[model samples]
Target: MSSTQLFRVSGISLLLGALISLIAVLLSFFVNPSFTAPPATFQSPLWSTHYSLFFTALALTLIGLPALYVRQRGQRGDRLGFFGLLFIALGTFLALGMAGYFISVLPMVAAKAPQILKATLTETSFSIFPLGGTLFATIGTILLGIVVLRAKVFPSLVGILLLAWAVLNLLGFALQSGLLAMLVALLSTLASAVAYGWVGMILVQQAGVSGEAAYQPQTALR
Candidate 1:
């Protein structure tokens, strides 16, 4: 396929991935909580549904990364773009691992003990996975913001928002209050998604330009 075609596909994939991820985020907060909770234990259907959507988002996001990489490669600011991709990949992995551990493991622990084991596992998961994942994700998102700003592939507004989002995420980590942390995390995730989605859109447009340039006649008919 031509560069234009590739980018077109990339744009659609990126948008689709972002949409799925947004759904996953919502499901995590809403659907997931309903499952395997008190009075129900190991009988909630929401748990399985939540896990399914979470994994779906994970898979789609991972698949979208390669398309992004292909779009950025060979560009003028390729290095920064490539670095951005690296950061994003690392962040994605960390986030998924943390989320997976919480959704999969915590449920079982809560189901079995319901008191001591549940609380202990919850504390352990938050202290270890969330803390570490947030740190890694914050760094990655910040780097990605820098790359996007420097490359000017997307709107400057998106870049600025990404940087701000990264700062907010880092602050959330430091504060450690449930309400405050959740608020910041939500903002950061949404902002980062917008930035990345814009990048994908821009890449798609550039691909069309690239295709046109490639087909232009060299040395006209002198």
Candidate 2:
């Protein structure tokens, strides 16, 4: 009910979301198909499970964003943090759309219309959602990292790690290897989760402090 309680709830939500996202990342390592794999790749149960987890992660991450924004807003570099939240929201929504396609549409198409597989694979640009989402996510993360460094809200190392991950992602994209890009993207996603967890912990700590501060005032009035 109180501001402190709100912060605590928000912090825990984000921490849980980060953990879910990490699990999704791990699932990818086991289940994701190679770009060159045949249409049969979509038939695997593991493939379905992978994207399901991804969908779950996107949902959780989306739920946590508001809390993260609330925590960061009005702090140092608030404007940058706002932009970061905007980009993250857009990217997450796009990713959600893509995940749904992979989980549902792709599998059906592979089973019923195998002839279309090569064409679908060849026209990677047709589904620009992932690419556009990655661009926004990468830029947003870099900007937020800068804000983190300037604000000193989270550890400086967290900011630096985000910046490094963004750079690696860009390099992967530039190299034009789908597999390599996917690997880098997974690594960066994991790092982002960790950074989010760190921010969540900080919020938890702030909540505790605010709780105590509020309690003391109440006791004085009693």
Candidate 3:
């Protein structure tokens, strides 16, 4: 594909990812009333909705990876860019795993105690999944952000935001508190939206133009 086409595809991927994430954020509140409240207990409806959104977001974020791969492969910075792609893949998997765990557990919990929506915090089958998933996703996003920044394939601002998001995610994990983690997660989501939006706008502007016509790199030979 031409450079313009590649960019357009990447831009579309980013926008889709952003849209899915936005939906997930909105669904979180409706699916689980406690989502707005302190993370005291998990509710079936809420957990279900959360998992759905998480998975959808994961799918959207991942859709862009291949485009990035095709653009970077065989290029000057293949090694670094490839590694970044790997990180994004890993993060996406972890995020999915987190969502999967929640989805699996909600049914069982609901079946046993349909009436009791809230339960005390305790070690359960579902709890660990989010923890692991969040960890991987956070790490992956951070790496992807760095790659984007270094590759200069997209705006540097997006990379910076990704880096900041990763740091926030790590901080949230370190705290091991729900409210804190959610807050950090929110920051990450916001940063992602901004980054994606920027990429989309750039792509739309550059569409139908050849890469050479749009971006001309200076070579040392010159």
Q: How would you encode candidate 1's per-residue C-alpha lDDT over 165-194 as one tens digit per residue?
A: 778878766765455555665676577567
Clashes of each: 0, 0, 2
Candidate number that wins on lDDT, 1 or 2: 2
Candidate 3 local lDDT, 38-72, one digit each (tens):
33335446667766876876676676556655554
**What is the lDDT for 136 in model 1?**
60
In angstroms, give how far residue 7 of model 1 lies from its true place.
2.5
TM-scores, all candidates, are 0.69, 0.83, 0.70
Candidate 1 structure, TM-score to reference? 0.69
Q: How much does candidate 3 score in TM-score?
A: 0.70
- Candidate 2 regions off by >4 Å? 33-36, 121-126, 172-186, 219-222
Q: Who is ahead in TM-score, 1 or 3?
A: 3
Q: Where does candidate 3 stray beyond 4 Å?
A: 1-7, 26-44, 72-76, 113-132, 176-178, 204-207, 210-222
lDDT over C-alpha atoms for residue 31 of model 2? 55
Q: Which candidate achieves the best TM-score against the true structure?
A: 2
Task: Report the C-alpha lDDT of model 2 over 1-222, residue by residue, as the tens digit.
Answer: 666877788777778878877777676566544434567878889888877877887777666666666766788999998898788788778878877888888889899999987788567674577788779878887887898888876789878877887887677666543566567767877777787787778878899999899789899999
